[model samples]
Target: MSETIALSFEEIPYDWRVPGTYVEVRPSYTNLGVLGFPARALLIGQQLAAGTATPATPYRITRLDQAKRLFGAGSVAAAMAEAFLAANTTSDLTMIGLADPGDGVAASGSLTLSGTPGASGVLALYIAGRRVPVTVAAGAALNDIAAAIRAAIAADPDLPVTASGTLATVTLTAKHAGAVGNQIDVRLNRLPGEATPPGLAVAITPLSGGAGAPDVGAALAAIAAEWYTDIAVAWTDSANLLALTSELAARYAAMGRLDAHAYAGLAGSFGQLAAAGAALNSPHLTLIGARASPSPPWAWAAALCGVATFHLANDPARQLRSLALPGIAAPAQADRFTPTEQDLLLRDGISTFDVARDGAVRLSRVITTYQTSPLAVEDTAWLDVMVPKTLSRIRYDWSGYVSLTYARHKLADDGSPAAEHAEAVVTPRQMHGAWAARCKLYERQGWIEDAERTVAESVFQRSASDRNRLEARQKVRVIGNLMVLAAMLQFEA
Candidate 1:
C-alpha cells in the first residue's frame, strides 16, 4: 500500500483505488555530475551627477555602454566595465554605483607651455599614460598651443579628466570627486623616437589636491545576500580595502557560505607598492601594481579579475599564469619590474603583470594579499588565487549533491533496515558511499588527489547528540599547480 521508490507524493492520492496507471512526476537532479559554477562579478564605483542611475543601486550589465550611461563616461565604473567586458563579456556583471562624497574635491593639474618654436612639431602629452597630442604651427603663440592641448583633451570623453585653458597653461581636472583622482598621473613623451617640438618647453604638474573618498560601505552593503565571486573595486584606499577584506571573510564563514574575492589596482613605484602590500594581509583581496600604464589601476584590476573569472569558471583548479588581459595596457619596459623585483613583489603579496611581445598586458601569476595566518605566523595556504577558487567549487559541488539527494530523507543508523526501494530512507552508510562517489568525481576532474584514501579516512555517522542529525567529516587534498619543474642533467662519460 506504500510506495518506497519515492515518497514525494502530490497528484497520486493514497486512497485512490479506481485510478489505473496513475503517475506522479518528481524530478531528481542528484544524478547530475559536478555542475557548472555560477560565476558572477560586481563592479563598485562612483557615479557622476550627470548620470541617470541612482546611487547605491545595483543593475545587471552585459554591454559596456550601459555602464557609461549609469556612471557617466570616464567614470570609475565605466573604466572598470570597459576593462571587464574586454576580458570577459559573457560573465554575469552587476554595477553598484555610489555618489561622490559630499565634501570630496576633484584633483587638478596643469601643463604650461613656454618658449617659441621656430619649427612646427607634434607635442605628445601623456595623462594616465594615454597620449593626447597637440600639434603646433611655426611661430604659434604659447597661449594658442595651450588652447590646442585643451581641445585635444576635451575631445576625448573617456580620459577621466576635463580640461580648461588659461593663457599659456592647460588645467586638467579629474572627472570624479575623490582622493582616487590624485593617482591619475601626468607626464610626456612615453614612446620611443618621441620628443618635444623645437624650442617648446612644457612643464608637467602632476594631479594633486583630491580628497574625501566616498563611504564604500553603502555600496558593499548593497551586495548583501548576493554571491559576487569577484568584485572589481574602484577605490583602493586602506579603509575600503579593509572593509572588503572583512566582508569577504565574513561571507566565507560557515554561517554565510557566500564567499567573494575583491580586486583593486594601484599605480605606484616598487617601494610604494611594497609598502602597501606589506600592510595588507587578506586572503580574499588582490591588489595589482601598475607602473607607467596609461590606464587607471582600477581598470587593470577589473581586467585581471575578469580574465581570471573565465578561466576559473571553466576549471577551478586551473592555473591563471600568462593569461592575457585584453584592453589592459602594460607598462613600458623601463617601468616594468625586473625579474628580481617581480619575485620580491610576489613574495610581498602584490599580484604582478608583464608585457607580452605584442604589447598586451598578461598576468604572470595572480596572488592574494595573504602572507600570514590569523595568528601572525607565516602561511601560504591562501597565497595563490587558485586555492580559494578550487575550495569554493569543491564546497559548491558537495553542497549541491547533499541538498538535492538528501532533501526530506529520513535519517537512520548505519545498519538500519531500510524498506524496499527506500529512496527516502537515508542511512549513514549510504551517505558515506555517496561521498566516496563524489570524491571519485572530484579526482576524475583533477581537482583532488587520492580520492580513495580521502573517503576511506573520512567519517560519516549519525550524530550522538542530535537523534535526527547526520554528521560527516570529509577530507580531500586539493591538487597543486605545477608552477616549477627542475631536473638534473648528468654526463654519461
Candidate 2:
C-alpha cells in the first residue's frame, strides 16, 4: 500500500524540525478568475538616416508623438506609428525601423515652368495630399518662379520628396530609396477650390525609376525571441510578404506557440488584387487593397492592425464591420469598388472596406488569405481572423492553467491508494473534470458555444507509450459572428 499522507514542499525539508512551530509559506499559482490576454502590436517599416534609433532595434512606444522623434519625421515607420496611434491608443505598440538599401535608387520627378505669369496668383503643389503653396507676382521670371516652388517643397520636413531648381526646371527627389517612393503623388490640385495659376504652363513628369527594396530578414531575426500577437507589415513585395507569412506560420507551431497575425495593404486594380489574393494560401496574413487614395499602403496596414488589436483584445469573436479607420482618407467616389467587386474580393481572400457618404473609410470585412486546405479543396474553417486569434487565447490560458496546476502533482489510476487529504495526486477522471471546468469558463466568457457537448465528448487517458505522460481527446466549438442577414418585406397585402 502507498503512503496515506505526504507533504510536498519545494523549499522546506521534513527531515529536521530542530525548532518549535516552524512553518513555511509558498505562493499559489492557481488562476481561478478570468485570464487577461491583451494583444501586443509591432509596426515594421523603413527608417530614414535622420532617425536616432538604431536599425533593426525594436522600441516600445507609449506616446503617439514618440514615433516621429524615434523614427525620424516623415519616415515610413513614423507614419505607421502615427496612423496606428490615431486609430488606437490603448494597445501595446512596438516599432522597428529598417534603413533603405545601400544601392537603392531614389525616384525623381521634374516640373518645368515656362511663360511668365500674367496674373498674380497662388500655385498649389500637392504631394501625397499635403499642399505646398507658392505665390507668384505678375510678370515674374520663370526661373525665379521655379526656384520659389522648389524652396516651398524643401521647407516642409513632412513631404516625402526633396526639391531642387535649376533655371526654369525644378526636380523632386524621393526621401527614401525604394519602389514604394514611385507612388509618391506629385500633382497640381486635388480639391475643388485648388487650381493652377494662370499664365504659368507647368509640364509634369511623374516620379519613377526607383529600385532596391530593404531586406526584411534582419528585422524578423531581431524579433525571434520576442512575441507580438499582431503585426503590421510595410513592404508589399512578394519576397518580403512571403518571409512574414512563413515566420508567422512557424510561430503557430506547438513548440513556440507564439502566433501572430499580419496585416498589410496593396495598391492595385480590382483584377490585380484578385489575382494576387488567389495565389496566396495562408490563415496568418490579411491584405487590404485600394487605388487612387492619397495615403500609402503602409498607412493602411498600420491603421487596420491598430483598430483590430484594440477591439480584438476585448473580444476576439466580434465582427469588425463598420469600424472607422481614423486619419485614413477614403478613395474617391468614382474610384471606390462596386458591390460586385467587393464580393469578388472577399472570395479571393482579399479584405475589403467601404467608404461612407461622409467620406469615412470603414472596414467591410476582415478575413484571412486561406481559401483551401492542403488537398486543394475549398475550406472555410480558418476563413476569418477570429479563428486563430480565439484559438491562441484559449491555448495560452489553458496551457498556463494545466502546467502550473500539475507541475509536481503525481498521476495515478482510478481508485488508486492516496492520502486522505491529497490534493496533488490526480487521476484520469479528475483531469476530465478540470477540462470541463475550463470549457465552462470559456462558455461564460462567450468565447465558445455548447460547452456541455464539448465536455461530454472529451476524454482523458494516460499515455500508452509513457506512464508519466497524460493525453486527452478534446473538442471545442468556437462562437461565430453575425455576418449577414436577409429579410422579406411585403410592400402591400
Candidate 3:
C-alpha cells in the first residue's frame, strides 16, 4: 500500500539563473614623454630630490620660470617654448616634464680693453646672438667703457651670462651651469679710430666649465614601473640616443607592453644622420635630422616629439600626416640639398621637412626602416607609422576582451553535458564571434580592410593538448597615407 499526498492547485515558480550580457572592461591608453629642455638640463645629469621616487604629475607649463627650474634657462627653455607653441598650434596641448636636483656649471670668460679713446668712439661686442654696444665719450676712461659693456650684456636675459669687470677688463660668467656654455662665441668688432677696439692683442677667454651628460637612466627609473607611449630627450647626441633606445626596448620586453616609442635628433648631413639611424638598428626609435643650421638641431626634434604625442594621443590608430606646424620653420643651412639629394635622403630612411602650400612648415611623411635586411624580404609598408600603432591597439583590445571574458565565466573540465553547455559560452566559436565584432569596428572606422574571408581567417582557437590554453592569430590590412602623385595630360585634335 502507498500513501498519496494531495498538492495545492496554485503554485509559485522561482528562477535561479544568471542573466544579462557580460560585457568586458577596456583600458584607456596613456601618452606621455620628455620632449624639451636645453643644454643646461643635460649638464644637471639625473638627480631626484630625496624621498621622491618619480617626476611630478604631467601637466602644461605656462611660465618661463617654471621651465627654467626644470630645464634651466637657455637653449633648452627655447626648445620647450617652441614645442609648446607647435603642439598647441591647432589645439591646446600639454607635455610632461622631469625635475632634478642637479646644478649646472656656468661658463666664464673675459675681454681685455686696451687702446684709449681720443674722441667719441663706439665699441661693439657680440655674445651668443645678441649685440652689446658701448659708447665712449671723448677722452673716456677704460673703466667707463667696461661699465657700458657690462650694463648692455646684463640687460639681455637671453645671453645666458652676466658681465663683470675691473678698470680695463670685463669678465662674463654663464648664468646657468653646463658644458653648453663653452660653445658661446664672443666677437669684438674692429673700431676705426686711434682709440681702437680690442684687436687680436685684446685677448678674450672662451667660456668653459659646462659638464655632465643627461641622466636619462635615472629619469626613466623615477617614472615608476609603468608603460609610456613616448620617451624623448631634447638631445641629438649619438650616445644619448643609443642609451635611450636600448632602455626603451628592454623595458617594453620585460613588461610585455609594446606601445613605447623613442625620438631623437641628430645634426649633420643627410647621409651622416642616415648612417647613425642604421647603426641604431631599432624600429622603436625614430630619428629626425636636419642639416647643420644656426638654430639648434634639437629644436626640430622637440617640435616633432610634441606633434607626435598630440597625434598619437588623440587618435592612437591613425597615421600622422599633412599636419601644419605653425611658427615652425625648416632648418636653414648653407649646404641646402637639391631635389635629387633630398630624394636620396628619403631612400635612406630619413624624414624630411618642407614648406607646404599653406605657408606652414610640415612633415612630408613618417617612416621606419630600421629592420631592413638582405636575409628577410619585407615591404616598405611595414615602415609606415600608423601600421604598427594600429596593430598594437588591435592586439591590446583583443587581449583585454579575452581576459575579461575568462574572468566572468567558470566551466567544469569534465566532459559532461552540463559542462559542455557552460563551455559553449567561451568556446572557439564564441571567440571568433568576438574577434569579428572588433574587426567590424576597425573596418567601419577605415583603419583596416574589410572582407568576409579576412574576418573568417582571424578566428581564435584552443590548443588540443592544453584545455586551459587558447590561441588567436589575425592579419590586419592598413590603409596608408597618400604621399606622392604622378599624372600626365594629353591634348588631341
Error of 1 at 22 (Å): 0.9
Give lDDT tens digits, candidate 3, residues 298-319.
4555566667766765555565
Model with the higher TM-score, candidate 1 or 3: 1
- Off-target runs (Cα >4 Å) in candidate 1 are 1-10, 28-30, 419-421, 489-493
Ranking by lDDT: 2, 1, 3
lDDT by residue for model 2 (186-211), tens: 77766667666778898989788988
For model 1, what is the error of residue 446's alpha carbon versus the real structure, in angstroms, after optimal superposition? Answer: 2.0
* lDDT for each residue of candidate 1 in 132-166, tens digit (9 for 90 to 100): 88888989999899889999998988788999968
Better of 1 and 3 by lDDT: 1
Model 3 misplacement above 4 A: 1-64, 75-78, 89-153, 156-212, 251-255, 317-319, 326-329, 333-335, 356-360, 369-381, 403-406, 410-420, 451-453, 491-493
Number of clashes found in candidate 1: 2
Off by over 4 Å in 2: 1-7, 22-31, 112-124, 135-145, 197-204, 419-421, 491-493
Cα error of candidate 3 at position 267, Å: 2.2
RMSD of each: 2.3, 2.8, 9.5
Worst 10 residues of 3 by lDDT: 35-44
RMSD of 1: 2.3
